[model samples]
Target: MQSIAVSMNLLEFAEPVLIWLALFFFVKSGRVKRFPMMTTYLAVRAASSVILELILNLQRFASVSDTLQNSIYFYTYWAFYISAAISIFFVIREVFLHVSEPVPGIQRFGMLAFNWVAVISGIIAISAALPLKGLGAGMVSIGFQVMRCVSILELCLLAFLALFIHSLGRSFRSLAFGIALGFGLQAGMELITSLIAARSSYLDSSMNIVLQVAITIVLGGWIVYFLSPEPHAEREAITLPVSSPLIRWNEIANALGHSTPHVVVGQSSATFLQDVEKVVDKILTKNSISVNS
Candidate 1:
């Protein structure tokens, strides 16, 4: 236990350092401008680690069953946890955009699919939390579980993109690898930590140590990926003529309740619909001219 304490202290101290460095590079590399959600994620990590460290110190010294300490713990934990969760959700979407940037159609479709994934995952998380409501650490458990699933999804998304487009360019792969490293480990560690703690009601310092180490590795990886020379992607020109069938299929997909323009918070249905309309009109007009000729 003495060794455990020393290690945990070391990791806890290191977390903020790594986070600050990660934040620095995130902005320095102009990633903050390109991927605002990821920038927010790094900022949250730095802030949350600092806040959580303070909270832990207070809780350890305070007498058990102290109401004020408990209240502070709950409120602060939930605040950071929720913020991190939301930021990660958007980060995943943004990373997908980066990977699929060359393919506009795929980008649009991926965005649509990601909306459904977010909605379903959120509903599942809320339902899971329902039973654990009122438990002191229930919200944290819920947040971790939801994040674990999302992180796994992120890994799969990256894997699929890599597999399908073996040459998505160097810059794209670099970003994708950085994201996968962070979230892939996150998903695995959170699955173990969240499940074990929720079942036993015991929060182990060892888990905290592991979490910090994983995060440090991820932050360091980000720094390295950013510093390396960005490989230029050879993008193929895509100019497939859209047909009436393609438009009908899109309309059918929308009608089948597969669309979430309204359900996806912050997504503008008006702009999305307008974009779709323009594309469809252009396609139909081109087809009409070709047929007439």
Candidate 2:
């Protein structure tokens, strides 16, 4: 029994610290903006793991029965599960923002709606599990049901997010790969858990932690790959064609007062026509328009 307790303690405590320490150093070597999203995920995970470890330590010290300790462990695990889900959602959103392309306004709004739904569902699950300060209607049944529902919503959101990533095309290579792999693992785990009974959901719990760590590590790699400044490309790029005639048109328009007439001052009709043609050509070139005429 003591050995069993020790094993649980080590799993809950040492594992998270080691994983997070790896995460901490990996992130410290990269850009600051990337740190907030990934670090937030790791931080919540660490807090939840430590809390679970303390709960287990208390149970061991007080010599609680295995059944009671298991019950406590189950509820605590759900709280952490919901938190991790929310964190993943945030990481996905951050990736979208980092891509710097405009998503459809409706799609953007859809992501927001999904975020709110996840938050509300997670709150409900947490409420059901812990009630007020760990004094709830003690059982894993309700929490499990709520989590199943959350997982379904997450599944749908994952699909929408996948489409969003797909629309980004090739520039999102690292981000798209990470997102698809993470969502695939997460969705697979959730489906398995939802299909199986709670007590026998070993793969669900174990795979979730594994997927999260993998996703976090991959996300960190993606950040380093993408977010690092593109100094070489910036230096090598051609300057925009600001000197093109289309931009000069704007200056010409400003120079010509609102009441300006269309007469050419000291030119023959053929020369005037030629000047207009040149102006039009300049306008088209400057504006990046292909004028067939």
Candidate 3:
């Protein structure tokens, strides 16, 4: 038990360091403009970690009442958690846009679909939480469900990149792909850990440590990706063949939500009536000639 506590403490200390390092690389890579949401996520997470750690230290040493400390910690932790979750949604969106950048039409259409998915996921999450007992419990349940939904989305995004990488002419080594890969791995670990924790309380402490380790590894991977020299050639605009399915779909998506232009009459009302009379006279003449024949 002592060893496990020590390990947990070490990880808690290590996580903020790893996160700060990752943030430094992320900014150094100059991807802050490209992935602002991801930047926000990292910043929020790092700040939250520091604040939470400070609170813990205070609880250990400060003369504050236990109830007051617990309340402050509870509210602060959940607030940060909720903020992180919201930031993650935007991070996923930014990555998706980057992946689909070469195809504007698909990116536009995909965003619409993405919005619908988010709405549906929120609805489902809220519905799942409705059965919980207290308001606080329900809110917490909603947060968990929302995170689970986002995790599933992360996995889906990774799968999409994996399956369509060749068709999209994107290399697996690209930063966008790396981001997806890291998040996908973390998401998978989170989902699995949650499931196991639900099944057995005995493993909760061990699983918490494992989850922390996985998160650190993900942060490390992000740092490596930012530090690595990306191939400039891959940055060139990809030209998909006109016959390619992606292109075809892009065209179809572009065509959606657009209506053909309505015809307009440039002629004055008198001219329009004259032309109508002329057409009517011609048709009548043709009928009279046929009758005579």
Q: What order do you get sorting by TM-score, best first?
A: 3, 1, 2
List model 3 lDDT by residue over 1-293, tens digit each: 99999999998889899999989889998888878999999999999988988887785687998788777778788778878887888888998887787678989977997899789978987888788887667667778877877888899999999998767878888888988999999999998998899999999999999999999899989999999977885577777777778988888878888897899969666777789999999999999999999
- lDDT tens readout by residue for model 1, 1-293: 89888877787677688778878877887666668888898889888878777776785776656677668878787878777878888888887786665455556777888888888878887777777757555677677667766777767765665564444433344666667557766667766876776767656666677776776677777778766655544233323335434344444544564555666568565787799999999999999999999
For candidate 2, write residues 70-185 as lDDT tens digits: 77887788767756766666665565444323323333554666678767766766666665343445335445555566456556645645554434332333433444445555
TM for candidate 1 is 0.67
Model 3 spans > 4 angstroms off: 59-62, 124-135, 260-293
Per-residue error (Å), model 3, residue 122: 3.6
Query: Which 10-residue window in model 1 sums to the lowest lDDT?
Result: 232-241
- Supply the global lDDT for candidate 2: 0.55
Off by over 4 Å in 2: 1-18, 29-32, 58-79, 115-134, 138-146, 157-166, 170-172, 176-180, 197-293
Checking candidate 3 for backbone clashes, the offending pairs are none
Per-model TM-score on C-alpha atoms: 0.67, 0.48, 0.81
Q: What is the lDDT of residue 109 in candidate 2?
A: 52
Top model number, TM-score:
3
Consecutive 10-residue window with the lowest summed lDDT within model 2: 231-240
TM-score of 3: 0.81
